[model samples]
Target: MVKQANKPTVWFNADEADILEAFSSAVTSTQLIQLIGPSSQLVIIDEAQQIPDIGKKLKLIYDNRPDIQVIATGSSAFDLQSQTAEPLTGRKKTFQLYPISFGETVKDTSRLEAKRLLDSRLIYGLYPEVLNNPGQEKEILIEIAQSYLYKDVLQLDSIRKPSHIEKLLKALAFQVGSEVSYHELAQTIGNIDTATVEKYLDLLEKAFVIFKLPAFNRNLRNEIKKGKKYYFYDNGIRNVLINNFTFPEMRQDKGALWENFLISERLKFNAYQSRFVNTYFWRTHDKAEIDYLEETDGILYAYEFKWKDQKVRFPASFLQSYPEHQTAVVTRQNFEGFLGA
Candidate 1:
């Protein structure tokens, strides 16, 4: 978008001293405008969450300067979202960029090439830098996990025990694709309470480290909705948290890993394509389950992820209940179509 725009653009890092100076009380809007000059038509601030009053600053720029379009980017939703919520309400649009999706990653590749890259992608994830670096995926993923992943969460004043957060994430890594219990999480991470466990999980979610898939429940007495399943935004980060990068054949949790990868990719695909849908996992007291479910436009879509191609049918209870719903098993052979790749 930036490259295609015909107007001159000015870029600013919110952490820079001069950018902060521009937002100071002493500097009038006119002075800041003069500093930017007339030709600068767009202003982009990266890591906008670093500035405490970024939303106010952006609101000022938006209200005062009609000619300059502003775009702000932040790594942590908790920081930038809260700071911008009231100030930019109805005045700004928001976009979230997740790790590169399968469609974007393989846009120009052949089916053979995509197949060749599948194993690596499943293990190391689709981070842009990881894709570009190729053979150094482990190093890149570890660096991202240790250095950049939790940086924003750690900076938040509410999170006092950073070590506990790390332990909490490691426990979550082991429980992907399964319902998580806050009480069990608290027990796993010593010195933390159930409330703290919930708070930390919320913090991790807002920071974009993880996302929860709530249970799909109708009014049926047997439907499950008491717990939620959490999945990482990136498979590589999850693997790094667990400190395991073994090949699929050598790993006992390959099925769970495949499920996580597919769900995460589908999420990115949906978000990027602006496909509005409510997502969840469906299970009943009798253990009849579907791995992923989507409700969109008054229609129910149920999907099961399989590492190998296999014929499967919808749960009998679900079919008896909602026979009009669509059901499909997404496997290695046809996942590209499922993810819109």
Candidate 2:
């Protein structure tokens, strides 16, 4: 729930706080006003997607009552928007509260503790239950997918078939941080069009399940026109779906996944920390690719993610073009320095 300045943070702790079930069958403004308590300023409805005509209802509430701040919390807002996008136009503010951010896991936790928890996050994912009791991982994951993931997908026309969606998710889990071809994905899941594939992927994005990063488009459009990369919101979720939750040392692709996950976490950190910046990945036709390209004002920050501590060589062509850009090596040995800097 979004924090309301008028109300105390903890409802139960406050003397004036009164949490009422604002859910109502009120069709008119009079009925809507009657549902909410007179003193109530902040309205928080959990599982808001369950409400019938959610978007229209929200818009009505927001429009009718300017005094009350409506903050509807739902794991799947996609359904609400699908029901009616116009009803809630320019009224509600959408904020994504993911399972748990990478920064959250390591905030107060010791480095050793963080590493210990990473394996569980890698496999079962950072979904509340799996992060809590990792033993019942498979059960929790399947339940989460069936309960929340399926509910929205089933409602969407693009993904009428649940089995195909599951198969697509499983296939994409292995291809984390890699460009996904819609045509190839459709072919793998039997008969489906590329547009359908794109639509299904969009549904996932809308639900905050996965994030797709478009290839950076500069004047060199041919270099980036090929394919866009897809990444799971949580590294743990990605690992779990792929069935590759081996120990860091034993897992060959662990480094790659970790790097990918860290990049996302860092991006999250920047956003949450209120830093103004943009992200990109620069690549040339000759196969020269820079992992991350961040631009703040006219200044550019280029990063290369590698597991090894060995030296990295930036392309001479890139230096000739953007000599002012800052380049750095992020590896096991130097990552701490990068973070500190």
Candidate 3:
């Protein structure tokens, strides 16, 4: 729709200093308001996060333009969120754009083309550019993580030792689909405090690098435990960071990696479809556990992910108590249905 805009559009590449000077100077917003010509009612700030005091300036622009609109776009959410919450408080809607989901990439699983799509997803992990060019995906995501995620972190927080942050993220990449211990991370990363590790994790999550899935509970005894499991936003980045892209099809943990990717993608699917969801990996002290448990609107979907063609059976406890929740095995054949959704 933006490409189809009929009027002439001008993009202003205002830097960090430009925004600071504009905010702390003798000239008020009234002077800046005069410069906005008749055709330029809608001011689109590209990379608005770079500009400090942007929240205040945007509120000023918004109040002045009763007829016009402001569109702010950036790779990270920090810029718009920090400022808008205080000054532009009742205004602004938040939306996120994720990598092309597997459903979007596949039209029908029976088609021969879908196999190729699956292979690409395995190697490239669904970032849009990787979908277009499957070969250079590893390099592209590394560049995004380093150049974009890393650069944005520095601007938001003051960390005297940035090296520890990289190690913390790389540590997270290896521990996907498992509970993360911030204390252990602090101990390993040497000299960095525990709070710093957690702060960096929150920042990484905000930048779309990682997602932590919380434990589930049905108001039962000893449920909803502490230590949430973490998953990287992309499988390719996870594999590359841990130096474990060693032909998973031939590796021992192929089953675990595939299961993690499938569960995470399904969660993303539920969210994008506007369905409210509760998720978990169910386990008991005795070691019997389901790979993924998902509940929505009082209905449940219990899933077990496996690579082999073993016989499936239900747990006596779940069948007796939680029979209302649907149960299924997500194996090679039936897995397509979930991804093709």
Q: What is the Å distance of residue 311 in model 3 from its true position?
A: 3.7
Per-residue alpha-carbon lDDT of candidate 1 for residues 87-175, written as tens digits (9 for 90 to 100): 99999988888988878767767667877888788789889899889789999998887776666578865667789988999999999
TM-score of each: 0.94, 0.83, 0.84
Please identify which of the two predictions, 2 or 3, would achieve the higher TM-score against the true structure.
3
Q: Give the whole-model CA lDDT for all candidates, comma-separated.
A: 0.84, 0.67, 0.68
lDDT of 3 at 140: 83
Ranking by TM-score: 1, 3, 2
Clashing pairs in 1: none
RMSD, one per candidate, in order: 2.1, 4.7, 3.5
Q: How accurate locally is residue 3 in candidate 1, as Cα lDDT from 0 to 100?
A: 42
How many steric clashes does model 3 contain?
0
Q: Is candidate 1 or candidate 2 better by TM-score?
A: 1
lDDT of 1 at 125: 86
Q: lDDT score, residue 153, model 2?
A: 59
